[model samples]
Target chain A: MTTTDLAQSPAIPRDGDGPVFREPWEAAAFAMAVRLHERGLFTWKEWAATLSEEIAAAQDRGDPDHGDTYYRHWLAALERLVAAKGAVGPAEMTARRDAWDRAVRATPHGQPILLANDPRSCAHRP
Target chain B: MGAHHDHDHDHEERWSEVELRVKALESLLTEKGLVDPAALEVLIQTYETKVGPRNGAQVVARAWSDPAYKARLLEDATAAIAELGFTGRQGEDMVVVENTEAVHNLVVCTLCSCYPWPVLGLPPAWYKAAPYRARAVREPRAVLAEFGVAVPEEREVRVWDSTAELRYLVLPQRPPGTEGLDEGALAELVTRDSMIGVGEPLPPAGAAA
Candidate 1:
């Protein structure tokens, strides 16, 4: 389906009825997923299915569905989709995540968290 | 204040988790050449500065000042909103639900985060969270109470379920005793959460502030 259809479709997430990102990283997670899907990495249908699965799985696990875990689910689904599509392996994602944790810790407040040259910057590695 | 400060460590840990997860995902997509960091940056910048709650606040201000505009807004929100230039996909089929002295309006998207991005920018984390979605529809009063908003018992609380095609924007009541205020000054009283119905506009003379 077209982007217009997807936007109007009940499937793909629109992130809300509009700038409500409580935290800075929520916006990043949202922009990341949207940009990836917009680039044709995955169809909106695929995205919806994966995302719904994450939400359902959470519900199954007794998640209160208070919306706290929404982005966590979004992240999980995105990771699963990309990993399944051969974008990155589970190990690589884990390693990069750890690197980001380190980078975030080492970086001071008010500075852009650059990934390169940071001990945990794995994306730039050959 | 100390109690609030005590949550800092928990907040920090959660923030790092979200931040690092996003970074990891972005990295994966970037490495695979499936996403452009520049494009993502542009999107973030747009939401951060432009196309935010300020736009909605302006619309509310205009409606408050101009009776003709308020009538038009109540009649056709999408068209009236577009007159202010909040058009396009996100603005289409937009419905403006007015809050009155007897009734308050709240909005939620239970399915997903279907929000009016053209005007509102992005949905805050809480708005997109499952708690807000599930509770806003089921127990709006409790949810509003958590936001420190106590709607009177006589005031009816109307919860609007924003969907993919249709989105709802709350037109909070204009504060009283602001008759001398201009549209721009009135707009200053319009806050982001108030328009979402989780809070109310500050009264005239900044009584709450």
Candidate 2:
């Protein structure tokens, strides 16, 4: 493929000749959904249904729904499907979320937030 | 808050809360053995490197150069596109709409962002926005104008609404000066927006070489 022509336009996100993530988290969210579907966790149809439901829910919650949070809805749908398939429970997800929030706060800016950065994990490290 | 501290890290660059949430969820899933980071890496890499609008550009370019291929594309887009090796999920059903002097075609998905992914890659942000979805069909001339396309008063604009089962790709009218250009050079002129009918292909300038 020709890289020069594709790189000239800023409308689409291109990292080199391929599509680039506008943010790292968008890539993460996208991959998680596709991977889960690949593992037969849920059909693409089910995933689409869950995603539309999430988008509708967000619209009800006063989201502008102008597509800025498209991946946010995607992440929400993946979480919902993963939970529904008995892969993970709501409680575990919440606990992990809190742990991550803690880890995120503990890590210095520009550094990767490692799970070990969670102070609770550090506390348990005898 | 204005006190200068001797820290090496810049305070302004921090992960968004959503980013933290994704990392946390990934960590949780990985710990449970539900997902492997390596597998996720491969998936992301595939989309990043292997799939994108360049695929669509090639299809448009071939159609522009070969009348037989254009006939095949217009007749059976799915099979024609697959002949060029661009086929996968979300692109099983395909429709190629052509733009002529008297007719222009535009595409949108009113319900959600249903796009021809195997060819076009991911739909752009605006394509998924509520306003575009709602307005592209209702007032396509106005929408096209916003994208810097001013269709003449006599030409008719048709809108194709893509769905989960079917997707549309616009065959933009080739510019006048591109007759001498080869297929590869022609592909260079086919932008992502042109195939979506929001804009026209790049005019042959330095591309004729």
Candidate 3:
């Protein structure tokens, strides 16, 4: 089904339906959305729209599980907020992620290491 | 949405093989040093493109703003977390254990790192395998101590054994001096390990340093 289908379905709650997290982290995210909405950072409608769009894209890519689909959407929502607010720039974020991948690759199998923090480095912790 | 069927149960074995294949490929690339540069580039882009850290940050933010929600979170974690707006499919079942002066909770899937990926995004490599899973649960205090978290001897340490069916995430205590901070600011204090219960959330801004 399309994201619009997911969004419009009565199975999903509308705004002011109270929290609807199935996972603890999802609840955590819902609470954050509430706080942000209260502070005028973004409306619940906007967040829902963004998340729905994310799910739709995942469906297009052949992911059928709505719950699994939401995690990626959740991450995208955060990235949008941080970027929109200039918490960190796209370039800096990309560089740090690249560094993390490199560290994981360099470490032996079964041993993953995160790069040491560098003041001059472009990556900031998420 | 659909009725449960016996065939769905059989799908598990197939997916496990798929997981194994992916891991094997990843390991092979790492061993060849072929994965470092490209993989890192791809890794960063993947998170930026496919996975984001917002979910984990949200949990941290909520605990800071609402005392009642936080209390519920520490108690019947599954229902409390569902109260927000996340659940289902990849979300799976979850349990949240609290860390306190008298008791500390740590989570690890010893057989395989069956993390709550829907909420936490991807599981870090260390979280998915034998060494860490086996060691962390067995000697939690020692492990935390190595991570520079010092738990007192008087506190009862509780290690939650994670399985494929039930995943666990640690609900760290809120940091001090964060009173009155907005949600975004509070989210900044959350760390990956804090949610995993390896380390506590950092003290607000400069409180610790």
Candidate 4:
């Protein structure tokens, strides 16, 4: 705690003493991590380690840590921990991610994007 | 069976890659039964609405108005905060440090953002960033200056590094001219930054108006 890292710290996005969520995804990512933790998927200790590792990796890769990508690292950590526990495979995650991308594109304006909206998921449905 | 629209890119075109990834992860987790969307919603609702600085504010107010409660808070923060109904994850262990005329206390997580979520909600973005984490312990006075706090030369600054096992909440010095204020009014003066030791509570002048 005494050692000085001297890296950049971002200003908090404050809405009168309340933490701000710039996007719905940010809140969702945060909630997902907490929910997973509550479900006993990974200890908070493990999650903290994974997140610290992710930030360190990004810092090594020249991420300024400007604060916006904090949750990106958070999501990455969650995914890594979840995958490491064998709860979800990387390949399946990639496949599901693609399905979601297609589903988002398929969903009409102001409509909820469902997995069924993805043509691939629909075609693969038994 | 599909309803095709050539102009359907609008929904995701505005979305960032990380955003899509979050949605994808949530959907995938839900499908696998590893996540319950409703449960996720409840957690989000709790953080957004139920838990936050107000909880810590109430504790600070009570501590300010009541010596016995403050004694319990400083001695056993975990049970004391739970006594006020703020016991949960990220707050299983608690330490309440007092700020006095001679000593000012500041908290940061040098390893990561380990905060008392039950009391203060989420850690602010800056609290989690590398700069604050690295600098707070090293150059606390300068950091406090950045947060618009100026610690006099006579006062000592003590920095607390929070961890997953333990978290801290600073019980800021109760403001002067507030002896007559009730707990609720006193709570209103307890800002989140004050409890983090970055800023002081609202002065009575502001609270009066």
Best model number under lDDT: 4
DockQ-based class of model 4: medium
Give every candidate's TM-score on chain A.
Answer: 0.69, 0.76, 0.50, 0.79
2 or 3, greater by DockQ: 2
Better by TM-score, candidate 4 or 3:
4
Per-model TM-score versus the true fold: 0.67, 0.81, 0.47, 0.89
Instruction: Report the alpha-carbon TM-score of model 1 versus the true structure.
Output: 0.67
Models sorted by lDDT, best on top = 4, 2, 1, 3
Candidate 1 chain B least-lDDT 10 residues: B6-15
The sequence of per-residue lDDT tens digits that candidate 3 reaches over residues B154-187 is: 9887888766457787777777787878988988
Model-by-model lDDT, in order?
Answer: 0.76, 0.81, 0.55, 0.84
lDDT of 4 by residue, B45-76 (tens): 88888889999999999999999999999999
User: What DockQ do you compute for every candidate structure?
Assistant: 0.26, 0.29, 0.02, 0.49
Can you write out model 3's per-residue Cα lDDT over A1-126, one digit (the tens) per residue?
455643443221112112233344433333333344445666544654565555456556775432433544555564466456554345655555554454444334344343542223345445
lDDT of 2 by residue, A1-126 (tens): 245633432242112233356777899899888777777888777877788788778888988777678898888888788889998777888888788777766677767767776778865477
Which structure among the candidates has the greatest DockQ? 4
Runs with alpha carbons beyond 4 Å of true place in candidate 3:
A1-126, B1-53
Q: In candidate 4, what are the lDDT values of residues A39-76, reduced to their tens digit?
A: 89999889999998998898889986756678888888
Candidate 2: tens digits of C-alpha lDDT, residues B69-107: 999999999999999999887788999999999899999
- In model 2, the runs with Cα more than 4 Å from the true position are A1-20, A105-112, A122-126, B1-16, B206-209
**For candidate 1, lDDT tens digit of each residue in A1-126?**
355633442221223334445567767777877776767777666776687778878888987655657778888888898888777778998888887776665444556766653554565456
CAPRI accuracy category, model 2: acceptable
Candidate 1 lDDT (Cα, 0 to 1):
0.76
